[model samples]
Target: MDKLTKGTWILNTTKHIVDVAQKSTELNYFETTALAGKTGVFLSKLVADKQEVITYEKVKKFARESSIDNNNRNVKMHLDLLKEYGKVDYNTKLTEVEVYCFSNEDAIETTADIYSNEIVDEDEDINIYSLEETYNVPRKREELVNKLVNNGYSEEKVNLAIKIQDTFGLIKVADNILYNEYTFTGNEAKMVKTISNISSSKKKDIEEVINRISNNQGLIENKITSDINPEIVKLMEGIGLIDGITVTSEIGEATFYTSPHIKGKGIKEKDFSLADDVFHKAKILLSCLRFGQEKSTYGRGKIDTRTKMLNIIRKLNRGEWLNPCTAVGQDYKLLEVDGVVRVRAFGNRFQMSLRQKEVGILVEKMILNNSIDTTDDMGDICSLEVQPSGIIIPEVRRQQMKPKEIGLVKELRDEMLTILRT
Candidate 1:
């Protein structure tokens, strides 16, 4: 793991449930904050009203107006969560208790300053902020505690510091293993929280395995799950962090664990600059790769439908024409209806191939690389979600092609086809 510098951890901001739901459009500051529920609304008001310095009495008033639980304890708990996020600075030692809200950057800097100011004499060297540098890699809690104790800090102080940082979401403890929460981003934070809340003895083992696999990418399922606990692999797959796909060829069958995040290495921007029909067909195939039914007439009873689909995609990628009646059967019909494959009359038999070769290559890259960007032209999302059984079910949405863009696509397609035929 790379070492992190203090105040330079590049912390990722968490999305409230509302933010995730309404991320399609730009939101004003107040709307963004208010939609996060009472805490967001409270922070919005504090910032909007220039309440840089606040009091507990004023906090209670805001809580009542915002329809929060509004009790002395609940309000303070909310305040603490906000303080941990570096959204507010509250002085615990003051007689009157002051809460300060600075600009986004200043709030974090101020929080670090506040923590630094409150440290005891013996704990001058290693504070919560400096801990980011050391705890970049996940470690068992006892291991971390022992490491810190060996460095001269009291066990009591080390534990207290860990708890405080955990409360702020800076450090996360899952399965009794301490993880730097800054290591996760976007929906990954939700996965971390889910892991934290679940009751399991295998979580520590799961983290270790994930750490190992992350270091060595492109391992097969058997290689990963053979020695480790099956339940742990199932849980990790269920949470959508790790996934595997079984691909079949004439030679044999093997399953490879693929990264959920796709890189789209061989795909280019011009690949999407083709005809709208080609783009739309590619979009359907990508969606089918994620949302299509898992069991079908073509695949074996025990094999996954995705594996069957990938086999067809692999054949198409090789430019071999398939006969709908003999070679691919009903699978071709399903993809034809989905607009991902083209079925046309060839001599005396019906033939099927991908709608466009370029589009087929795009799908191939998506499967091979694991991450591709189609948000602009295809409206297909790169993120994935899986059931506890490890079946992927990504959200589906389609964008309508603009009239002007449609003509451009047609012109480009004609030009490319003419050049290729020559």
Candidate 2:
């Protein structure tokens, strides 16, 4: 890639990427993977006026480096998480996510409601495993495989993972990606049930439908177990699935799926695909988790995509790039439109929205804070300040509050109130 031209720097001299990077135990800063975490820790410190930097290149390089290098391994991952969430930050760790689920709003009959079946109701709170739950630890995977193998699992199935790990390393266990093959636990029954119910005239339709939609595997299996009729068995067998799909009748207590890779063992969603850019995007989203104001409907997926985007942005900046800025969440899009990036977390998304419009005011003020730049007059470059006149209380508020203090009566009736009151 061509190095970013010098012209970019002149665009915004106040941008400070070097300081955004965490001080390195090795040299200038911690690797890019650690940037998001550092950014998360210091997010509160950044002000609307201060320039926030997120390095795309060193971060991207660090991601690629961690994937390849075995030596810096200890420093590479957070001990508590024990897995790389592609490139997620500390906030993602704290943010709650949703389990894979389905919408139940359209169901006409309450009888159709199965307790354990995946269903999302409007505004109902649901819990989801974090990205860390979705990913496998590099060390733990090794230990699990060894324990499973020694316990007499078929060498074929156990070694399938072994072969995967040997060639692809950690990616294989986490994503089940191999040479044009993928694997997951307990997906066979659901794949079977869905296929067997196909009508004679709807074979193409059934298969086509199967090509789309990732059913929460556990849900389908739960449905199959509770209502297995003879017809369901025939339907199950025709789809190459055998009976033993275990699920409980327990209706709803909000249990989340533990497995991230399995959609059902035998069936894969052939209809869906993530573009290479999207895949990279997904990777970054997986790396950086959300810290604040992500709802259940958009929570998990948003965190995934955003993490992916930030990591890529951080990586791309490794070369000489312009005075680019990136912030934690969607709350910064308004500020972003003004040629500023908000890489720091700003509490919650709601608070983020509140401050976005004041970017120009904040940037100017931030420039003044550093007091680093000097003008031709030998004074601060942003010497001009807009000190706000104290706000006069509104008449409506004065009427509503009906101040208990006597000072309020004179101040409200005389010195204060909107000009309309006079």
Candidate 3:
């Protein structure tokens, strides 16, 4: 009972009930119920203060001292009323009492706000930029901006840095700087070396020019007179060393590199355009099929096989020829003639002919067979209609398909079919 004296009244209603009960000559039934409600509130606060179990004897004693009804019947009746209103634990026995906290809607909302404010205050003190200073980076974009600004970097610089981070990747940039190495190869290497010999002031100019180029979508006037050495620019333009970038005396245009390009060569100059197109199509089709398969119950080995096939296609598109051992569960020989690359399958179980042709058909057939094999029915896809885009395999009809799966199937099927025909 002494423990209740230390408890703070969180709700103002507790005071109002006491004042009204004191002023009234005699409390009616309604006033008695109100007094019980106030007692319940006090009991909850007392439990919160104790931070331990409250016994029925202690609660009953506290109620008597507080000038409320001390009779066992009245106390039990009020306790049951509190339980009915969800103010206290409904399962609380007569011997033991457990106060339910934040039981009121208002109390729950107020508690939530208090917790939210505490989290915000703690976050405000954290410096989330400059991993060297903070030891961690903020995951949120707004916090990242604030942290960079606090680290003495201008907003423009922070914006540009974020763009670079997004483009080349933060880890890649860090690796290059830490290792004191360049990722550029072939003609790009030469350009880097040439730029390295420039004066410090000129380097700053080049940096500004690059920033402008990035911001303007690769279109900018050659304004950096000192930074951009005319001789180096002319040399780069003459040798076709710059890919996805063009510089004129009046205007310079730049584009991000989506596909790998060799120095001194453009994508149009390569004779593997047909193979490239077919390979891209096959990749899309396979990716769609893999997505569909993942929604259903798929074996881990089948997923691994699908991922391997995608990697092979990506490597081939990057101008790297694959040996038979590099392929997944199949033997392949990559042959390049007159800049046209063709993949020939050796020991192919399905195709009898050993003749080497375009890699598109081989890839398509390999993926199709692999997909069919993983399914329960061996000939399930055999009856599927082959359209110009690709084969339309029926989806496994099951209640397990979620809304997300439905959307994925529709999108992949549409894109896959479109690419297969082309």
lDDT score for residue 194 of model 1: 44
TM-score of 3: 0.19
Off-target runs (Cα >4 Å) in candidate 3 are 1-33, 49-52, 90-93, 102-422
In candidate 1, what residue range of length 10 has the lowest lDDT sum? 393-402
Report the C-alpha lDDT of model 3 over 122-156, residue by residue, as the tens digit.
11112112222211211345455666677666766
RMSD of each: 22.2, 27.6, 30.0
Better of 1 and 2 by lDDT: 1
Tell me the spans in candidate 1 whose CA falls farther than 4 Å from its real position: 1-224, 243-257, 267-325, 345-350, 356-359, 366-422
lDDT tens digits, residue span 1-422, model 1: 12112222321112111223345332222131222234543443344113445456665765564445678787777677667666666667521334445222333233234323432343323343334533344566787788888877899877766664454344545446555422222123333454454344555665666555444333445667778865555434432345444433333334444333332446443432111221123434554353332322222221133344456566776766553343333334434433245556655445666534555665566555532223222121111122112211111000111122234333332232222222
Q: How far off is model 3, as Cα RMSD? A: 30.0
lDDT: worst 10-residue window of model 2: 122-131
lDDT of 2 at 239: 19
Between candidates 2 and 3, the lDDT winner? 3
Candidate 2: lDDT over CA atoms? 0.24
**Predicted model with the maximum TM-score:** 1
